[model samples]
Target chain A: MANSVTAAKATRGINKTIIYIVCIGLAVLSILPFWIMFVNATRSTAEIQSGLSLLPSTHLKTNWDVLTSKSFDPLKGFLNSFIISASSTALSVYFSALTAYGLVVYNWKWRQAFFTFILCVMLIPTQASAIGFYKFMYQLHLNNSFLPLILPAIAAPAMVFFMRQYLLSTLSLEIVEASRIDGSGEFATFNRIILPLMTPALATQAIFAFVASWNNLFMPLILLTDKSKYTLPIMVSLLRGDIYKTEFGSIYMGLALTALPLFVIYFLLSRYIIAGVALGGVKE
Target chain B: MRRKGTINYAKYGYIFSIPFVLVFLVFALYPTLYTAFIGFTDMKGVIPKPVHILDNPFQNFKELIFDNASFRQSLSNTFILWITNFIPQIALALLLTAWFTNQRLNIKGQGMFKVLLYMPNIITASTIAVLFSTLFAFPMGPVNSLFDALGWSDAPIQFLQQKNTARGIVSFIQFWMWYGNTMIILIAGVMGINPALFEAAAIDGASGFQTFFRVTLPSLRTIMLFTLITSMVGGLQMFDIPQLFITPAGGPDNATLTTSVFIYGQAFKGAYMYNKAAAASMIMFVIAAALAALMFYLMRDRSEGQLRKKLRAQKKAAKAAARGM
Candidate 1:
């Protein structure tokens, strides 16, 4: 028995070491592409063409010059993307919460049906409706405008569904009743009491909403034809197509610049983001 | 004196729901119906004209199903890419989740590992595609240089210029980007299983593999179904990377052209066949809806269903006794 126990212990130790090695290897695999992109961003075109290096060089300023000298301006792209993502995220989170509250608080006949409708709406992919949406926007001359992009976010069905699930678990109808007894209006109660109660859900959903909007390339690619109004993804795509194709260092720099904001955001709020994904997964 | 009664707050529901309802009607519902409607019409070109309903409403559908080689190829490509990536992705995710959530092998620094692993997912697909393209650039790129240094090949391989290599890279990118997400989700699922079941398994002398297969896997039915359905739906809509990765959008004989890319090309590129694009969208919608329906069927509450059946049988017996009385 003693010999068997020691054998098992030794096997377990070996297994643990193997698991750690695999885990570390995967971690490196995950970050290697980003590291390579950043390192290549700092290297000259010739250097990049010659070979890959794990170390950074001093050609970043030169690459930046090449990037800006072209039609694709990273700063302007950042501003455009920020404007679109911020507006959409704010609208989506607030409106979704409001809709969830509306569904939950009031004892209405159509409440269940409306909630079911929203659930169904959540399954409908955006790409399914793109053709008609594009045509309709074009007909209304809403193309090349951010209105089509930002305003439609007010009806984010998936976010509403998530918020509804959140409210179902956390919200107490007693609070709404208490506020009503205290002479508070329904909307006022929602704004003050309910919104505050939903801060955690709001923040989590807001991060997801912001990231999704920031990374959105399909709708914007089709809708916004004007270069001045181009978002970062579109700008990065253009860099691939134009004469900047041969400028390898600048191309890498542009790619890095596009991904940098997301990296910064992820590093800052990674705990929340990972937690949010886990939470979202659990509800299903 | 007012009678004690509950206030009628039914109208408040409608009042509060007005914005969501209105926006849903205009933006979401309307656009979907419009797509369906235009699918039956003969609309094309950049100019917006009066869309006349085709004599055969299924003309575009019939043509696409029967005649359109590119659409068929794209549909197959979409499935191939999704299946190739999804199989490996789920395998790796399940393996990692098992390890991460293992009770005996409590891994340290899981948080840092998770953050790093999930980093690739947050980056824009367009940018990732471009980065990969440059990394594997023809003749004198990072990948080629590495191969040369290692003496792997006599000549540099044109990674993107070839059909299979292009498809493989796209599939690999999809796999790399999504495995972390799948792992996180599965970890949540594993974490949610009742500790009692695990304890029961342990007490019964169940090995770790046996416990996972019996106790953990069975308990994760709902969450597993959720992940599968969502991934399926998302996979069907794969577009950004394939479109932006190569020039001429779905190049090298269109080996990487997906259903969404096909629809996009029809609507926006070349002749601007909006009707055809709408038709393809409707087809994809049907496919997605079918998958969702399958999920719902699989995820239906079996206990509730059995309870309802028992209640109905009990009610029948009660009715029979009352008739006898």
Candidate 2:
């Protein structure tokens, strides 16, 4: 009986290990595209088309040069992406955090109604109004500018929801009461005391908003038409082809350039991504 | 927070909320209401647009939902596509979550794995579409090379050129993008469970499978429903991948045309069909609203029932304890 039990335990251990390996191996397949993208970026397009090269190649600089040259205007595109994403992030975090703070901490008329409005739009995917929004922008005569892209981030409902979660964990009504006793105005207290307390949470949501705005393609695609105003990815795609199909190396180089910000951001702030995603999904 | 000496609290409160109201009015509320208003007109996409009277969108709505065969076909295809995409997304997320929770996975860097999987999400869709374009290009891509190595096929296959193939690959990409998100949520949900209950199950000689079935799934009922419903709402809006796949040609044989894409194509991409586009968008909005309502209704019912059961169990246990005392 002892022998049989011991054998069963060993078998179970082996099976658990196998399951773990298999599951994580499947997860690796999830990131395979990024790996492939990196590989393609490093090699010459000819070498890429020919076969998979396991290691980084020396041709990266030439590819980098073409990508960064005046024709690409890589800096301008990066600057454009940066300006849009940063503005969106600042607007989204400020507005959403304020609304979230009001909803959670204050006693306001229609608070329940306001909350219901927030909840209703929570899961309504962007697709529902995507076309409508595009046409609306066209008529508003704002389609050509970045305002159409950056303005919407201010009312980002998800950011509001995320802020609510963060504030719930970090803030207390007592703190507000104390601030009030100290003769601090509500906004002043919120801006100074609450904002300081909420910094970590703010960072998380800000990163999320930044990444989201940075990655926004469909809206920008349908809204912005001019080549001069294109974000990095948009500019890159235009480089590869809009009038004519170009060389694969330039396009691959363009892809590498476009994807670089996200890669760097990911490496720098990976911890917050998990928290932001989980916070949104937690309640539901 | 308005205590006896708190200085000018109301003024500050109002000040902080201005940016939010400004943005909401300019962006979300304005566009949404304007879209619905436009739906009432027969206006197409350009200036001096054809208006067929505001009161009657019946014809346009009818064309979008039932009368036009292509619209109807895309609708059916979208339904099929949503189900196919969501199945693998939810399934893989659940499996990954369970593995992450398992003591034996012994994974050295679990958080790193999650972050890596989620990396694709940050890249622009154009970049993703472009990456996929190269990865599966005819005669030259690595996927074809792998097929060649396996002797599965002698010739190259243009995966995105054909009708069903294009839809399949597009759906596959959506599934790939969403799974990492769902998996992370499920991981957090699983981690939120009471470890004591799981330990109790183990002491009773219950296997991992039994514990998951008896404890984990039930506890995660709300979250699972949430994932499923949101996926249905969002997955049906397949536009980008299909558009890029069949780009430079409005879609191969129109097989890759999504409803949003079709509406967009009409309104701007091709000849402006504003009234038709607006009508289609209205119909699309109605369907989405209905689906969202239905999910919420169902989810509320399930949770309410579960809540009742939990209350009853607690009441019974309390009574038994009182009697014993």
- Chain B alone, TM-score of each model? 0.90, 0.82
Provide fnat values for all models in the order shown: 0.77, 0.50
lDDT tens string, model 2, B57-151?
Answer: 47677666667876776677777778778898888888777777876446557787788777676677667777787677777777887787778
TM-score of 2: 0.88
Query: On residues B18-133, what C-alpha lDDT tens digit does candidate 1 reach at each position?
Result: 88889888887888999999999999998778889999999999999999999999999999999999999989998998899888989999999889888789899999998898
CAPRI class of candidate 2? medium
- Number of colliding residue pairs in model 1: 0
Q: What TM-score against the true fold does each predicted structure earn? A: 0.95, 0.88
Runs off by more than 4 Å, candidate 2: A61-72, A239-246, B1-18, B45-55, B104-108, B248-250, B298-325
Per-residue CA lDDT of candidate 2, range A1-284, in tens?
Answer: 99999998898779778876875776677667667677667777677667665576767876777665545777778888899999988978777888888877864445546666776677665655665687777768888789988878877776777787677677888999988888887778878888888888789888877877887666777778876677776674565354324345556667778888788888888788777788667773
Give the count of colliding residue pairs in each prediction. 0, 1
Model 2 RMSD to the real structure? 6.1
Candidate 2 lDDT at A228 equals: 68
